[model samples]
Target: MAKMVDQNPLKFSKYIKTYYGISFVEFLNRLKIHYFLTHVDHVDQFTLETYIYQSGFANRSTFYVAFKKYVGVNPSFYLKELKGK
Candidate 1:
């Protein structure tokens, strides 16, 4: 991304922090979470584990941690709530 925009990597990271109020990794995780939420249901299987990998999460632990951190609930609980509605 820095190379694409002609920015230094450190400079780009700082810019992301200053502008978005989060580090680049957090920003990326948020993007992946959003993608998962929006696109997971579109998958034919509809399995959370499958979606977890598809969402660019490295593994279940990482996915659970980031999902809870950003979404304020674990994916299973969140999805259960969505189903209840």
Candidate 2:
């Protein structure tokens, strides 16, 4: 899709930033984070760390940051909140 618009990734990323008010990386990160949130529970995980990597986050910190940014809480807090409900 990006190629159809601009052959250069840098230019296409710039256009995404110009229009979306965020860098393309942010856009992709948010999408990945949301996908993780929706599917994280349904998927079997032998370890939380494994799930984090499988969800497309490079590491736990990156996942935590994105989770906090979008969900307004870190994963641990979010899990606690879920338990309270």
Candidate 3:
């Protein structure tokens, strides 16, 4: 796909880092978190741990770190805020 797009993997990664101000892995995690949040109601189990795993995070700590970086709060806080709305 990178070759099809006329970019090497290294060059495409550098472009994303430059444009988005974060590493490619961080950007992908943010996207994963966003997707999980927006599409979470489809899941049967609604635990935060479940959500973290579904969001493509390997562990709670990493999920929380990425979620906080992208959303400016912890997932619990985000859920609370969502509930209030």
Candidate 4:
């Protein structure tokens, strides 16, 4: 089995901010929403986790912290809002 490489979420976030003119957390929120919309067939947690992992979040705890900071709510709640939109 191949070992998975660990990603540095903060570094990746910095890059996003440097190039995108948006805060890292904002970029992450947008990514989460985009992922949900693109893969609407998936359940909320699945989409959120997939985006969190794919976007170089160090782990679930970090993802949750950053997500809450940017989104003003938890990932689940954010997903619920998206559904209502």
Best by TM-score: 1
User: Model 1 clash tally?
Assistant: 0
Count of clashing residue pairs in every prediction:
0, 0, 0, 0
lDDT of 1 by residue, 1-85 (tens): 8999999999999999999999999998999899898985565477778888889988999889889999999887887788777
Residue range 1-85, candidate 2, lDDT tens digits: 4778656888888888998889887887888888777875654446768778877889999888888887888888876766566
Model 2: runs farther than 4 Å from truth?
1-6, 43-45
Clashing pairs in 4: none
RMSD of candidates 1 onward, in order = 1.6, 2.4, 2.5, 7.4
lDDT of 4 at 47: 56
Q: Is candidate 2 or candidate 3 better by TM-score?
A: 2
lDDT for each residue of candidate 3 in 15-59, tens digit (9 for 90 to 100): 989999998898899898888778656444577787778778899
Model 4, CA-based lDDT:
0.65
Encode model 4's per-residue lDDT on 2-81: one tens digit a residue: 11235476766666779998986677556765554465446545555666677666577876776677657887786677
Runs in model 4 deviating more than 4 A are 1-47
**Which of 2 and 3 is ahead in lDDT?**
3
As for candidate 2, its clashing pairs are none
